[model samples]
Target: MLTIRPATSADAQVAYDIRREAVRHHCIGAYPAEQMLAWTAGTAEDGYASLMASHFYMGCIEGEPVATGMLDVNAREIGAIFVLPGYMQQGLGKQMLAFLEALARNLGLAQVNLDATLNAAAFYRQCGYVGEATALYHSPRGIDLACVPMTKVLV
Candidate 1:
């Protein structure tokens, strides 16, 4: 069984590691290896710490940090939803999504938004997030990635 709980700064490295695995192993088919590796390597402590401190970032796991995601509670923005390759089909991502959605509801957020990776567009759609737009994400280092901007308005 997987459990969802608040993530701490100490989990920064683990979250980064999970994000790296998700981008490489699961997203390699959609993005070039070089671009993916560079993107993953560029993310580290500073960003994750700030996110844990302010947002509703939660880690889901059976034993360890198998997945992590965050909700920008005020804006109801969901970010960095990742499930390690081996843990993908086991429903851990769903568990993490549930936590973020519940947090959004509890916070009285009227809507939630996310930029979904190519492979994850369908999943987000299934979760009731309509595709509001498509974007060419130009990384700070100039790597271009395709993303679908999605939104779900809550009652």
Candidate 2:
């Protein structure tokens, strides 16, 4: 059985680990390898603390975090929707998205925005997100990466 639980302070490291793995290994984006190597998801000084500050969700099967994502109510955004490799094609991402969208609705956010990784554009499209714009985002160390901006209105 899959369990979607409220992320606690102890989960910060694990969530950060998942996010880092997705960015460095799984991502098929315009981000350069040089930039990817520098990604130290919240295990570092700056971003880890910030990540620890956000509201996050962890999807566990038998208590292992196989999928993770977050919703930032203050920013009206959904961030870091990722499923570990073995967990792919199992509808975990869609479940995470639906849960986050429901949270977004409850938070009074009319729309939720996220920067879709290049590989995930098709999936996000399948999930009913429309393109908002495209941009070159600077990853760690100012490495520029192509990102598709997308949004889904909750209304």
Candidate 3:
């Protein structure tokens, strides 16, 4: 069973590790080695601490965080949804997504958008996000990645 709760600043390192591991393991064939390296380059100082203290949530199983998700209420965007490699295909991603959508709905958001990575587009599609045209997502870390801009209507 997976339990999710708001993440604190102290969970920054764990979140960073999960993001790095998920990107490295699951995004292998979708992006080139150099691009992947650049995508996962920085430490949690790259805004994770603040993010955690804000809208971030960690999904844990037996008290071990195995997934991460964030909903930016102001921007109406879903970001940083990643599940550990070992936890993939177990419906954790879907659960986390549902949780985020619920949060959005409770906040009276009409819609939520996300720039889904190449490897994660299909997953987003399966979860009811609509959008297919690929776009170049300029990461805050100074890397441009091909991503599918997707949105889900909550209203």
Candidate 4:
């Protein structure tokens, strides 16, 4: 069973690890190796802790966190949705996304936006997100990643 809970500042490193692992394992063919390396090089201090204390959440199965997602309420954006490679193809990502979309609705948002990684665009599309043109997402950790700009209207 997957149980999701709000993450605290203490879970910063855990979130970071999950993101790194997911990107490294699942984003291989979508991005070049060097870009992926730069993207995942940073530690939790980069900003995971603050996000954890805000709207970050972890999805745990049998007490082990295997996925992460974040809802930027202020920006009306959904991001950081990642699942550990071992946990892929089990519908965890969809569950986490549905949870976040519900949260957006509760906040009175009519839509939510996200920058889907090249490898994840299809998945978001399958989840009912409409995609715009591909764009470069400049990561705070200093890497430019190709991403699809997507948005979903809550209905």
Best by TM-score: 4
Per-residue accuracy of model 3 over 1-155 as CA lDDT, tens digit each = 99999999889989999999999999999999999998888899986667887789999999999999999888889999999999999999999999999999998998999999998998899888999899999877778999999999886
Clashes of 1: 0
Q: Which pairs clash (backbone N, Cα, C closer than 3 Å) in model 3?
A: none
* 2 or 4, greater by lDDT: 4
lDDT of 4 by residue, 130-150 (tens): 996999998776678999999
Cα lDDT of model 2 by residue, 3-97, tens digit: 88888777777777777776665774545676566654347344553555677888999999988888989888788787877878899999999
Clashing pairs in 1: none
**Model 3 TM-score on a 0 to 1 scale:** 0.96
Q: CA lDDT, every prediction?
A: 0.78, 0.78, 0.92, 0.93
lDDT of candidate model 1 versus the reference: 0.78
Candidate with more favorable, higher TM-score: 1 or 4: 4
- Candidate 4 residue pairs that clash: none
The 10 consecutive residues of candidate 3 with the worst lDDT sum are: 46-55
- TM-score against native, each model: 0.88, 0.85, 0.96, 0.97
Clashes of each: 0, 1, 0, 0
